[model samples]
Target: MVIKVERVLHMVGGGGETSYATNSRLQEKAIYRTKPILEIAVAEMYRTLLPEKMVVVDLGCSSGPNTFLVVSEVLGIVGDLCRRLEQKPPEIQFFLNDLPGNDFNNVFRSLERYEKKMEEENGGLLVPHYVVGVPGSFYGRLFPCNTVHFFHSSYCLTWLSQVPQGLGSEQGVPLNKGNFCIAENSPPQVVKAYQEQHRRDFSTFLKSRYVELSIGGGMVSTFLGIKSKHPANDELNYLYGLVAEALNAMVSQGIISENKVGTFNLPIYGASMQEVKSVIGVEGSFDVEKAESIWDPFDDSDNVLSGKNVASTLQAVMEPLISHHFGDAILHELFSLLADIITARHLLKDKCNYTVLNSNSLSSCHRRHGH
Candidate 1:
């Protein structure tokens, strides 16, 4: 099995135009869209029990402004809710997790200012939560048993730990063919290979969390996904189609070789609601409480930023992966085309065909039943 794990696919680790920090407004919007769920989780936890000490884990917490956004929200919620109930807020131990290649420096640097901001906003009434960075893959155990109480992640699960295996020929050659992700024209075998990898990774994710979450603890996660099960329903198919077409046009102009497209496969799969439900149902550790596709990840409601928001957002995280595969030479050309495509689509219609998912932001929380 051949699998490629390019470092860039992890995330853009800075505040540049193509960096995760600059382009994560979509994720923020997604987070806000899921506010009702967060409120329920916070309310439930504090209502039933408020431990003197508690733990919260943020997985796939990349180096960006959004890095601590959810953590801050969780802290704020815990503090406010406890105060309302006349209970002391739990002493929080916050853990930020990501692959080893992620930029922890940028994250650490922002901590002091973020803390100051939190302190100022809460009128010095905020609980001081301890934060630690844990670097590793969440597809496996990331902490000691019974350590975390509440877990959160967003905009990261679509990434497989490695490229899907078995997309090669008997001769050990790549069969995905000139595409970096699922396409409308992609072969069934290619699609199957990607789907299998998502199911395996998602199941591993659930089992690992089951081990780490405390009794009655839960998780909140989000992914960029859709509700349709058909492989063609993938939004990446459309977005990357814009990219693949541009690359092909360049191929005809002889800017690059035709063979480049044959080996590149986007190591991403936004799980459909059906796909996620199947795994959660099978894993049996976490119950899928709400698998609703709330809002479009690309809801440019009033054409404000128009489509630049979409392009910049995708560019920040994708530049590394796309440039890694195609070299940085053609990126400017590639995304410019993508921006135009997004703008035209946004202006012409109020609703998008593909639902932008950032689910549980994977916000699925499983109560520890039968534990």
Candidate 2:
């Protein structure tokens, strides 16, 4: 059975050992690394439109310190721009969007502290901004037409709307056995199925967002990607391939069914920059302004790789879906096995999983055609 990602997927909740909030240093580093790009996008959009109220949305904003990091980045850029221009700052409407299962309650509880911090940082003159939570899948419409002025999403678009179909036979037999995501052994048909699913999902996402974004508006997005179009044996595939190995280990001990391992696949695709540009071109709503692959923030050559740290981070992101499919019993042992495998293999020593950064400006033709 194909899992409904919106319903099943979420970061590990609460401030616990495996919670995303605690283990998200990698993503936090990514946000900071991409800050300059975000600054440009926000400043350029504000300068061109000069709207009285600037509306910004952070899609797939899982609850964490990074949740408000994007908001603060936008506020600081726009607020400073207004000062330089000697114009009053525009009212900022910020939306933090994620799937319904995200730890929004934790995010909500942290707001008071964030606001107090903001007030103190602003010297008691808080920037004119309103924050709200928007829970929904970004693969479909989430806002009214022509409302949003800017959008920022980081480490999110890699998630597919649903698991790719055709991994199984007409009689309900598994095809891509002994693996979860794309791997060196994945059959050509399995790979094509995943590629087609990503194309469909990305196209739908762009069409929906284009309808919601106002004329001349823009977006900055950063997502995990592969340096090469061939996904097999790529950095991302190897990263997830380790997890598949752990599962197969369990299957050997009869801790989990082999069929279960055969049927499950991660709903994520590490698209190359070429694939991203191709989708944007075919979607026809936005013009790609800039696109490039950035260095992997997780790679730190100065220190030896810590298997526990890597396992915790992946657990924070994958635990919910893993538990839903494989039962809670497998979580602790599963991650423990994964940790041992990482240390034994020393897989991350020189590997780099590239991140794709894109800044897209809504096309004028979209406005002219009233699309």
Clashes of 1: 17
Error of 1 at 268 (Å): 0.4
lDDT of 2 by residue, 58-149 (tens): 99999878898888788889878888988888888999999999999999899888878877897764359988999999999999998999
Candidate 1 — which residues are off by over 4 angstroms?
A: 1-3, 169-174, 234-236, 297-305, 344-371
Q: Per-residue lDDT for 322 in model 2?
A: 91
Please, what is the whole-model Cα lDDT of each candidate in the order they appear? 0.74, 0.83
Residue 182 local lDDT, model 1: 80
Q: Could you say which candidate leads in TM-score? A: 2
